[model samples]
Target: MKRTTLSERALVLAPHGRDAPIAASMLAESGIDAQVCTGLPHLIEELDAGAAFVVVTEEAIASADLHPLSDWLEDQEEWSDLPFVLLTSRGGGLERNPAARRHLEVLGNVTFLERPFHPTTLISLARSALRGRCRQYEARARLIALRDSENRFRTLFDTMDEGFCVIEFLDGPHGPASDYVHVQANAAYERHAGIPNVVGQRLRDMVPDEADAWVEMYRRVLMTGEPIRFEQELVATRRHLELAAFRVEPAERREVAVIFQDVTARKRAESELRELNETLERRVQDAVAEREAALAQLHEAQKLETLGQLTGGVAHDINNLLTPITGALDLLSRRHADSDPRSARLFEGALQSAERAKILVSRLLGFARRQALETRAIDVSSTLEGMRDLIASSTGSGIELRLVPSPGLPAAQADPNQLELAVLNLCVNARDAMDGGGVLTIAAEQAVVGPGDAGALRPGAYVRISVVDTGAGMDEATLAKAVEPFFSTKGIGKGTGLGLSMVHGLAAQLGGAFMLSSALGDGTRADLYLPVAQAAADPAPVGGNDAIRPVKPLTLLLVDDEDLVRAGTAEMLRDLGHVVHEASGGAQALAKLGPDHKFDAVVTDYMMPQMNGVELAGRIAARDPGLPLLVVTGYAGGNLDVGLPQLAKPFRQADIAAAIERLVHGEKVVRLRPRRDANSAA
Candidate 1:
């Protein structure tokens, strides 16, 4: 319900001239909505301004050139039948013309009366016309209001510079693809296409590929009976178009309406984004590959560094043993009489030195290869259980051996033999530390070390086998070199000190952490943190198989570029009771064994001029088909042992005896195991 306010009311008046005053008098009396006009033209202008009705004298129509007024009256719209009245003379015997009656009828909504009519009659007719005119005035007011609103909307939409378009379905085919025609478009669309009229044309004709896409989209929408909206790029014109289209079906119309905007700049930005993504992906791949390669190289360097350390330590320990081993055996043989029963003491001393040499050689072989290993991953509890007898023996009968294994202990990857040796070394050291006798306690538990536990150690669980002793520990100076080869706290000649160094080397090789703690008065604690190895793989043994093969002996022609070695070896051969010849050089040896001498064996030293051991052996083997020749040298030439036995130089007389005895018996020389230290950890 709309309420009409005072300002919206229409006013009425008689045509300008004689009745204008009377109409004013009627308005003054009535106090209703009203205004006055001079003529039909003035009436139209007043109506245009805001007049609603008009009144006039009938004689003015007779005297007036009424075509202008008639043309104006004819122009009045059907709904706005402007209320009009005519005052005429009815008493002068004037007759109305039929044509004029028809003409007056053409001028719609007209009233007439005689000139002498009462004021009440004029007022009654005026009031009725006023009422009808007010109804027309309401209709006219709404039509004008609509026109104003349309103008406002058009002004706003047209002024915006961004391109916008609206599409609607038409009743018939519209293009080559028969795309639905557009019903409306804003000024931007017209500007883009450089066309004045855009509406009623198919979308494809206006935009590229718009026909094929839009018709298919509309077909889907018609079936789905749902509104679909999206942003898409059409590729036909090689231009980026950011478009949003939606299906719209009206209640009374079958056409689906689509509204969209053009966003080419947005599409270009998205393309650039994809290219940037490709570049980032490539960079990430390169970074990952570079990181992997760096890690690989770092690991290789670490392995080589560890190998160098172990080799140097082993060499140093062996060098220290060489003097005692070779010198002792030589002295004992020269000094001890065969008839003297007590002379066996000197022989026994020499035997111990020789055994030490053998042990040193075994460690070197182990460093080279590990093939047949007695490996079993056992927890500290199991390890302690097996060590009771050995520990008691190492610590002495007076001192106690305490095995304290933590609950839920993890298993350590170790060879029972190797691990036992290490433990024994520690025990022996402890027993030596506690000369007055003290307790040796072994603590075992699962250990987890992250960066928080050790400096830059990768986080993982391990078996921390800590051997703690209640004996008097070493001073700071002595403790620092506890694991250095041949470094001993004991007085001179009491300890060889290869024990702890071996433990350290073994732990490092197993990828484990070895941490030692000790104070002047406090007992030592050596914690061996072995990484969690696979449960069954223990420390494997190396050189388990004798790589040397057996062969027949040949007529002997032997050489040694060194005097001591050559004379000693010849003496050893005489001891073995074999017929032999000796030469100071390779050339002399080859001259002794002629091409047709039918030699049974040939022995030659490798590092010699005038035909080295390799050339001598090759010439001999070429002459004899089933002969065994042994090449002895500190260093071998390439291909020196291709078809014959090869031996290292600086050997004992017994080693030479063993090599020949084995070769004569067609038995290969097997590498012996290192005699492990039994009194390790106490």
Candidate 2:
């Protein structure tokens, strides 16, 4: 009782006799489902309802209206071509009967089966028709599946975020892959590329200027069937894009799929960030350089201050020791002037050597910027002339000396003795530089300084005395520290390293400046600038005091902490025909004073224990304001403001006598001393 489907049943139309019944029986016996149509009207109705095939006799529709049956065949779906098995009388086949052709025209897909033939022939023709109808149904199912897949693909392709397109490479006039056509493109394509309606449009027509690059990129993907990813700029639209391209399957199809997105903003931000980093890098370098310069300056100041303190302390002790030696030697030489010739000569030689030691100590104090300077107006030309022979002897024969003093040059303010020593030191250094042989030129010229010039020099007229030498010179690193105390490049025991430092200190003390310039393998030049003198140079003094003796021998109180120094000074004072009271300290010297023992003057050492010379002077002044006081010191600089007559130590008997005589006579002893601040020059 199951219902039959169109593809599983057959319709029989043979209403003329037992033809319809006989055909239905044959189909039923063959195990095929069949429907018996009563007439042509029933056949049309059964055809509309659907059947796999039809079995009809020729007599039934040969002379009847075949329009409805023909119309049904014409109205069938494209995939439907209903099969028919036609039963014909003798000579009723299409080839034998002319009427059979009309029936064939009505049944589009029909097979002719002649009547009076075996029933096997009818059954075989019905089976063949049903097989053809089954194939048509399978084709219809495939078409429906293909249509549904296309719907889903189109929906996804249109909704994706990234721009997508299918391009078909074309062979153009130029060559293969010379052009490509955009066969398929999605909605995002226009938004990303700024081109609209690109389907079926050639790349050359859309962006002619950039077409070649685009085609070449995609052509490789198509030819090699490989995928590529890259970033590129679309010159036509001025947009930067990140794109990925892959060849479509089946290489011969010559198609590539491209996915891309706009990346212009990101690229611009990266460019800006790169520039900002470069700027910051330069700023950081500049800041570091500035900080290094400041640190170097601070280090130099601290180093100089520390060195000055150390040098001053050492010079003080040495000067104290030298004072006793020099005083004893002077007394011995004078006493032995009429003794054995050999003994007298030995004493004189020792005295001369001690004087040299005193000069060396003075030079050390100068490098420390604590030495007292005797600055005065002096003719540089005359001074150099006087030292010509002496400088020549110091430089030796290998070096040629040249002195070029500018004519009409004004006098410069400086210590003449120190200036001569500075020039001699420079010449000796020049001689050392030239191991083979070279010329050493000393020149003097007038210079005027203005504000904002180098070397921090005060604006004034000055005399520039330069020492130039042709010799192996110093490089920048060495030149920068040439004037620093004890920073020497010479081998040990060859140089003291204080020559240039002494020169620099001397210049500064005299209100001048010193500068040096040199280059490796070129040569060196040292320039000393001294301020112009306010007055003309003083004329040479005639012979006066070769030996200073006090006006008359008087009672003297001599106080010093060093036993040897106090004993030697007491001996000198007694030999000068003065009654002397020797004390080891300020307190001892104060105790010696009483009404029975009167003293004409008190000579005290500035640096001592128990009480210093200044404090002792104050106490003595309270008791006897009219008594003369002389303060002698080994330490020459730094905040020693004693309002009494002062004499630097390491002096001969004549120097001490001169100081005491000046004090006793109330004569002012002018001394050029350094300021209270140790950092400032004298």
Candidate 3:
């Protein structure tokens, strides 16, 4: 093998240019590659560039500023211990010089030699220092490999398909390992168990019902040193659980690892399959019965699918028609300026009717799964209390209205306004059902539901609000279709049949459940189950009338296909002190904006012939990246994801002004009252 070189590459810090070359020659003879640095800055640069060792003269370290050298040494990692050699005079002046002594203390691994020292001695010292440095490099390489291995393991643990946890057996006051503490767990453990923040918690404290049995099973595993696998019911979540537990061998403490999954759905499916087989045998004896059963199921499925498609299409078209009408009303309101009382009242009545129509459309669309909800934490007791007067009026003198609220009930996580609407709808239905005048009770209470208890709802704490009525109850068949849209027993023109359907949609969309129970002669009880909020409800702020800010004159490019909408919007912009330029389409707008021509901002409509707003934005970005763009849309299906500012149709003058102000002044303005992205998943 070839001879190994000492300090394979070296950096010399010698302010004297002539002394640097001499040092390089001495190191080169020993097959070491060496470079000379002229000053402290140059020396630091060379050290940062990865030198094996640093060599300097006593005069350089003593006379020159050594603060930089001190800082460089302070920044090194524990694994890094760079070797250095100092050439000093024959006198032992370094011990007496405080500055030199301080520099020596800062540069930890430094060796010194007199001027008359032998070349072999210097070379020998370098060889020893290089050997120690080689070990450090080896240790660093091992540390990096260990970190990579740990990251890989953690990724696999977090993405497991089943729950996994490590439990350490704990001793009770008079029992042998009667409980266990969860020491470590993966992300999937929380998801599969439907429990969060489980680490460091004892099993007995978390679920007292199953504590004894679960502890006994693990205790057996530890005693026999054998693994056990079984399927059993989890009492806490009421779920059928399949798990395997084994003692961790050679561990210092008594520990075991458990792996499990909730198999409730599988169990239910198996039970249904068995029941269907029994029914098939009976139907085989009567062939006509089997065919009729299959035919009825298919017909019901197809009818619902067809109705949903038609309703969704009609709702979209109606919303489009309402957009322009609402926008026109806004402009008219501004023109009237609340100066005439008669005109103002007429305007207010029309606006209220229009708003009611919008809510009706929203309910229809919501039942069709084409609407979004704005969810928040709301106090159930307070919401019911506020509606006491309205509920009493809705029942009239015929029925007695009662409100009963449970004490210390937690707030529910839902949209406050939507929850109010759901409660109101339930009350109306109850009142109509009790045609002969009876008692109507509305009550709210806290409840805990488990995995397989509440249908289609996960295990958690909930706020259950019930509305009971002493009414003429419906039969089983009618009760089954109570939540179906457009399914009603009321006479023609009596109701639209969307009350219960809308309530059901509201609960589902807000991540809750709705249930209705009734009998032919008895009363009816409707329960709305909403998840309990973890935090207190936020207080609603009261505000006075908003004062509009005056806008400075700005040159703007406005693009839209509709002449009426474009004209109305341009008039509004002009009123705000802006000089507006109109373009009927995106192509026309681009032509107006040539290479040399520019404007303050571009405002364009999303749906247009030839080129849409998003495409226009892309072209503008390519030409002038700094120019700001805003897109307006009347169509409901626009999917512009360029992160440009957007305003929905039917926007008031203040809405558009706020959107523009956000773009120009870096002020945060709330976008047109709570809109979910059209492309977002329901």
Per-model C-alpha lDDT, please?
Answer: 0.57, 0.77, 0.72
Candidate 2 colliding pairs: none
Model 3, total clashes: 0
Model 1 over residues 48-151: C-alpha lDDT tens digits? 55444566666555555666666666766533566566666652122653334643654555666456654544565666666656555555455555456556
Q: Model 1 RMSD to the real structure?
A: 51.8
Clashes of each: 21, 0, 0
Q: How well does model 2 score by local distance difference test?
A: 0.77
**lDDT per residue as tens, model 2, 1-682:** 0212345799998887888888889889989999999988998787776788899888888888888878777877755677777778754444578886677667866666665754645776677667667766665554455446456556766886668788998999879779999998999999989988999998888988878888888998888877777889998888888777777666878888787767776665554544543443344345445545544544454345345444643566667878889898788777766666787778777877776677777766665657677678999999998899998999998889999999999999988768988999889889889889999999999999988777768998999999999999999989999998778889855886878988988888888999999999999999999999999987643321246654689899998888888898989888888999888886788788888789988888887754677777767776787788788888773225656677887878887777777888757533323234332222
In angstroms, the error of model 1 at 329 is 0.7
TM-score of 1: 0.34
Candidate 3 structure quality by residue, lDDT tens digits, 175-284: 97899999989887766678788999998889988888888898998888787777878777677777777777544579887777777766555545445434433333
Once fitted onto the true fold, the runs of candidate 3 whose alpha carbons sit more than 4 angstroms away are 1-312, 315-317, 328-352, 385-397, 405-409, 450-459, 484-486, 491-498, 539-545, 595-597, 609-611, 635-644, 667-682
Task: State, as a TM-score between 0 and 1, how close model 2 is to the true structure.
Answer: 0.53
**Candidate 2: lDDT of 581?**
87
